[model samples]
Structures are given as structure tokens and as C-alpha cells.
Target: RVSMACCLNMCGAVHCSDIAILGYHRKPPMLDHEYMDKMCEIPLAIAACPTAAIKPAKITLPDGKEVKSVSVNEPRCM
Candidate 1:
């Protein structure tokens, strides 16, 4: 028989045990471009990513508002 626990305490059992269950919650951040310019600091967000998934990008809206945005590489995001 095998026993497992949720990884809330960062215990090392997951690595050495014969069968251990490890789970983590990972949800990529949603980008709200309409309010992004006023609310977020692009450079800080990019730097905060541990996996280097956030990237700087630009978009031109139909209303002709040129806004600075970010692109997230979902595959690399964790």
C-alpha cells in the first residue's frame, strides 16, 4: 500500500516514495487590455514570472487606441 498527502508543507516525500501524489494549482493570468495601460506595470509583471513566460507586446484596437500588452506562452507557464 502507498500513502500520499497534498503538498502544502513542501515535504520531500514526493521524490523518494514509490508512489506519491503531487498536485499544484496553475492558472495563467488573464490580460485585460482595456484597463491594462492604467493598472499594471508591464516590466514588473514580466520579471515576476518564474518561468519567463510573460512577454511584452503591442496591439492597435479598432478604436485606434494603441496599447501596450503582454503575451503569455501557456506551454512554458508554470
Candidate 2:
């Protein structure tokens, strides 16, 4: 999971394979998953972001495999 935050003092993007999603601003539940390879449901995850900070990306992994994932575009307020 990922979170989009806006702060004038901080820059850069952070990605995490596992995360906790809060419900109704309540306690968040932990989510664990395996490798995030191509064909992952990235658009679905990005769609969940209220800030619209994420977008689908074509990235080459260390293993030389290209995959579709999400990347955060910082410095822009969505």
C-alpha cells in the first residue's frame, strides 16, 4: 500500500509493498503480499488514493523484468 502526503519541507516518493489502510479514520489493518510484478492491479490501488498522487508506471526490475506499477509524482497537489 501507499500514502500520498503533501509537505513543503519534504520531497521525494516512498513506496511500500505492505501497508495498513485505515477505515473511517480508525485503526488500520495490516496487509501483506508477495512480489509486485507486472499485471498487478495497480490502477485499482491508485484509484483509491484521494489525493491522486499515484500513476501507473512501466519500470524495469532488478531481474530485468518490466512491470506495471504505481509511482508517486511529488510536488504536485492532486
Candidate 3:
């Protein structure tokens, strides 16, 4: 069984389906983008999202490459 700490700490890898068993937001919030690459795992989050509100967004990376990232529709989430 994956712990919520694992999910929150590695949320970039955990998703909606995983949430069904793993729980949500296990750890305290992190404002840093150090592991942004883990955002690639958002599809799992989307799958786990009961509200179906999670969506994808195009983000311009620091290196000037455009890529997809998980974005919550609300301004607070952005």
C-alpha cells in the first residue's frame, strides 16, 4: 500500500486512479517547482480526479520549449 506521504511527496507520479487507494494531498504543500518533470504524471491525477476538473495546459519551459502541464481551472490553483 502506497502511503499518502508517498503520494504527496511524489504526486507528480501519483494520479486520480492512484488516489482511489492512495489518498490525496498527503503532505504539506510545496510551492517550489524543483520536480516539475513529475507533472508529466498528471494524467494519473486527472484519472483520479472525481470532479473531473483537472485539465492540461501548455507551458513554456525555462529552455523555451513548449510542453503540457497539469492545470487546475481555478485561479487559486494556477
RMSD of each: 9.5, 11.6, 6.9
Q: What is the lDDT of residue 14 in candidate 1?
A: 64
Q: Write the per-residue lDDT of candidate 1 for residues 1-78, one digit (tens) a residue.
A: 344543333243565677777665467657788777689788976776667787988978779988998888989866
Candidate 3 lDDT at 6 equals 30
Instruction: Candidate 1: give the clashing pairs.
Output: none
Instruction: Tell me the TM-score of each prediction against the true structure.
Output: 0.61, 0.45, 0.45
Output the lDDT of residue 39, model 2.
Answer: 38
Ranking by lDDT: 1, 3, 2
Backbone atom clashes (below 3 Å) for every candidate:
0, 0, 6
lDDT of 3 by residue, 2-40 (tens): 324234334444443445344455333342233455654
The residue-level lDDT of candidate 3 at 27 comes to 38
Model number with the top TM-score: 1
The TM-score measured for candidate 3 stands at 0.45
2: Cα error in model 3, Å: 6.6
lDDT of 2 by residue, 12-74 (tens): 132432543322322222222224443346666566656676666677767786766667655
Give all candidates' CA lDDT scores.
0.70, 0.48, 0.50
Q: What's the C-alpha lDDT at position 37 in model 3?
A: 50
